[model samples]
Target chain A: MLKVENLHAGYGGAEVLNGVNLEVKAGTVVALIGANGAGKTTTMRAISGMVRPSKGRVLVEDLPVEGLAASRIARLGLAHSPEGRKVFGPLSVEDNLLLGAYRHLPHFLGFRSKAAADLKKVYDLFPRLEERREQLSGTLSGGEQQMLAIGRALMAQPKVVLLDEPSMGLAPVIVQEVFSIIRRLKEAGITLLLVEQFAKSALEVADYAYVMERGKIAVAGTPEELRKDERVLAAYLG
Target chain B: MDTSVIIQIVVSGAFMGLVYALVAYGFQLTFATSKTINFGQGELVMLSAFFSLTLTRLGAPYWLMVPGGLLFGALLGLFVERAAVRLALEQKSEGWILLTIILGLLGFSSAENIWGRDDHPFPTPISSDPIHVVGVDITPLEISVAVGVLGIMGLIELFKRRTLLGKAFEAVSADRDAAELMGISSTRTVMLSYALSGAVAALAGILVAPITTVGPTMASALILKAFSVAVVAGLESGFGVVVVGLFLGGLENLASLYLGSGWREAPGLLLLILALALRPNGIFGKASIRKV
Candidate 1:
């Protein structure tokens, strides 16, 4: 459902993503794993229009969306939960979620009611969020914030979701909980492109996976095939 | 001097202070969304009042003239955003400060050409005769200023709190990138803020014009005091501006009464310098913590 072709992007004259190519087909979880500074995050950002690509194309449902404004890309049904869980700090959790559905919901009155069902779905996925719906999102724990980020992305009901570093800065227990939520999302048939530091867990949940090196994809295979690659096992699994 | 006389001066001054609060609120609006404010806001005030005066002279009723003036102000605001702010913000530069100031100067010259250099009395159906209430005399014109200022402020505040679009505005203010991911356009939000700021400035002009008279320079002193209020109260809090505006107004009146009439502008300047030196973030503003 989402495709990237020869994407080249960077900040200021320093190219971080050089001719990186990838795809996330409908109803499958694709994990992009690599060590620090391997351009995984930049690739996600370029795909979502956060960082404009220097060259190449990004397609959401086969429509070229390269160089569009991030909000325009979002309205076209691509939701990106960026690194750092950049939730609106002063807003309540419910407001953050409602805004995630901004393109679909009414701009003025009755938006709360229109978003009621999506809110319920997210709250069901993370009951902790429901309990703290009225609380300011900034005060939430890291794990809760991660859940809110993921929940917020889901609120958009987008065609594809790019989730970057969902496990960053969390306890192992919380990371496990996050993965379980990912598993649930996958089971529910959501198309996702996940970037992660934890290769083992990512491989376990991914239907297909790509290992990135420098600024390009180094290996691509099914998760089962990836698990048996000696080089992949040595560098990442170890 | 009688205590009642002192009460009258403070009360009257407080009403005028509310006008400053209204203009300061305009600065807060644009600052919230884009972190940029129009340096030409005083000119916007003066121009809108002149426009309303022309409308009155053209035989438009007060009711029709008010909305007409506000709409004109909103369009001028959009012009400022497009001409002065949008490019600078996109390029991530502070060039807007100079650009808006230049635009204000152009507006000042234009007003001179169109309305002439002399102050003109603003005609109003509302009588200026003071009404006696609890041993104090207050004019309907002054009461209308308070009501208009507070009414518009209340309505804007309500829009921000109760509407989804308003929440989206707050979202952009809090985090621009995250808001974009949510499909909220920060550029449009900034535009909306500028438009609202312009409308508010126009309302301030309309409300105070009857008392201060309509002239190219009418808003010069008022804008300075409003700037002081915005700085002292902090640009983020709506309620803070009103409180600080009222306090500064009363203090200035008392200064003029006791320390000579020439001292009218002293308190606002002193308060501004004190706020800058002691509380740069403002009394109501939270100290921002940079998380690396």
Candidate 2:
């Protein structure tokens, strides 16, 4: 559903993503695991057109989308839950979710009614979000905010979702809860490209996995194949 | 001085102050999305008023002219965004400041060339005849200003709260990047804001034209005071500008009454300086809290 070929991107002169190539076939979860600065986030940003790739081709279901505006990429069926859970702090949870479906819904009146079904689906996924629907998102706890982020991305009903560090700065218990949500989403057949620091937990949920090192794919295989490899076991699983 | 006279002066001044609030609200609209204000906003007001006056001269009625004038203002706003602000915002530079100022200067000269430098009396259907309420006499012309300013502001506030597009606007204001992730284009939102701001500025010009007259320099003093209103009230709150505008309006009138006509402009400047020195965020503006 999503493909990147020879992606190169960076901040100003410092290149962070160097010829990174990866793919996630439809209806499967792909985990990108690496240490800090492995270019996981940069890869996600380049795919979503947040950070313009100096050299690369990003294709969403065969439509080349590299160098398009982030907003344009979003409209073309890519939802990016960026690192740091960048929710609109002043907006209510319901409003945030409603905005996640912005491209599909009407711009003016009657949008609430049209978005009701999508809202219900997300609310069911995270009951806590429904409870605090009217509350400002910024005031939510880190765990709830993370759920809100995932829930928001789901609201888009996008062709592919890029989940970036869903467990970052979360409690262990909350991290487990987040992983369970991913499992549930996998069962529902959501196509996702997940970026996670928790390699073990990610591999458990991912059908396929890629280990990134210094802005390139160091290893790639099924989770079981990766588990049997010594280099993958020592460098990441250890 | 009779207490009734003081009330009369304050009331009249307060009506005029509503115009300042309307213009300041224009500043708030653009600032909400872009974090930049058009320094040439005064010229926008002047130019829009002149355009409206031309419509009047072309034999259009007040109702027709109002919408016509607002449309012209909205177009001018889009032009300003395209010509002055968009490039700077895209490059992430502060060049918009000088660019907008130059646009304003160009607008000023354009008005001089098109309409001449002389002030002309703005003809209006609304009567200037004062109607007495208890002891205070208020003109229909002034009442129209109050009604027009409040009506537009209330409509805009409703737009922000009730509509999905408006909510998108607020989302962009709150966080530009996050809004983009939702497929809400910040550039379009910013353009919409400028259009709204321009329309609001045009309305201010049209409302005040009968009392102040239509001319190239008509909005000079008005825009300065409106700036004071925006700064003193804080640029974030709609309600803040009205309260500050009214207070500044009344205070200036009282200052002129007691101190002298020469001291009329003093109070607004004083309030602006005091607000800037003491509370730079504005009396109604909340201090932003950053989370690491």
Candidate 3:
């Protein structure tokens, strides 16, 4: 459902993602695992149009999305949950989620009940946010904010969602909880592309795996194939 | 001093405060959107008032002239945003204070050339009839000032809460990147903020013209006090600004009457200092995140 072909993207004078190619089928998780500054976040940003690719194509359902604004890319059903859980700090939890659903705003504005039902669905996915519906999002815990971030992107009703370091700054237990939620999302048929530094945890859930090093994709394989690969074990598993 | 004197001073203060709140609201709008202000806001007011006076002389009715003059203010705001504010953001200019002040001076000088540096007569739409309050007389203009500010505040609240563009604006104000991620055009929202601010400032100038008289540089001191109001109330809280507006107006008037007219503005400013000392975030403002 999504494809990135020979993509090249960078900031300032330095190129961070060079000649990268990847694809994700519907209803599966594709994990890109790498070290810090491995161009994982840069790749996610390029795909979402937060940073445009200098060369190459990004396609969702075979429709080219290069050169679009981040918000416009979001409208094409590709949502991004940023690396730092960048929730709109002063806004209420509910508004933050509604921000995720920007493409759906016109649909909701005409029918209050529809918006309410959507909110109820998000509440079911993460009950804590419902309890803190009126509380400012910045006051949320690391785990809660991560959940809120994912919930916000889900609010967009996107066909593909990008997850960037959902585990960073989160406790091990919270990380497990967030990953479990990702598991639930996969079971519910939401396509996901995740970038993470935690190899073991990411490998367990990732259907396909790609290891990146210095802005280049060094290896790509099925999860089982990568699990047995010697380099994958010696370099990343340790 | 009789109770009558107190009431009359309050009536005057309230009237001036209406214009004060209007001017302060413009400052608040610009800051809330771009985390910047047009210190030239004063020029917008002075120029708008001068334009109204010019129109009145040419036979335009007060109401007809008011909107026309305000459109000029709005245009002025748009121009500043396009040429100055946008340039600052593009170049990542750190000296917003200096740039805004320079713009203010430019605007002031432009109006100075037109108005010839003199005060001119500008009347109000409201009748000049005076109403008695406990044996003290107050004019309808004063009443209109209070009522007008309140009315605009209500309208603004409704617009922000109910409209799609308003909601988009709120989103942008809270988080620029996230708003962009949501498909909101940050450029449009920022320009809208300036437009709203300038329009309100024009309203303030036209409203106060009958009492203060129109002049090229009249809004300089007024804008300073309005900036003080924005500081004391905090730009994030629109409601807090109105409360601060009313309080400062009353305090300024009371101080002038009881202490001395030269020290009239001192009380409001002193109160601002006190509020900032107690709550640096602002009396009703929220504490935003500070990057280390």
- State the TM-score for model 3: 0.90
User: Model 2, which residues run further than 4 Å from truth?
Assistant: none
Chain B alone: TM-score in each candidate?
Answer: 0.99, 0.99, 0.94
Q: List where candidate 1 sits over 4 angstroms from the true fold.
A: none
What's the i-RMS of each model? 0.5, 0.6, 2.5
Docking class of predicted structure 2: high
What TM-score fits each model? 0.99, 0.99, 0.90
Better of 2 and 3 by TM-score: 2
DockQ of every model listed?
A: 0.91, 0.87, 0.44
Tell me how candidate 2 scores on lDDT.
0.95
Full candidate order by TM-score, most accurate first? 1, 2, 3
Pull out the clashing pairs in model 3: none
Summarize candidate 3's per-residue lDDT along A72-174 as a digit string, tens digits: 8888888889888788887789878776777777622453344677778889999999999989998999899999999988887888999999999999999
Task: Answer with 1 or 3, whichever has the higher DockQ.
Answer: 1
Considering just the first chain, candidate 2 attains a TM-score of: 0.99
Taking the true A–B contacts (Cα pairs closer than 8 Å), what share appears in each candidate? 0.86, 0.81, 0.41
**lDDT tens digits, residues A21-48, model 2?**
9999999999999888999999999999
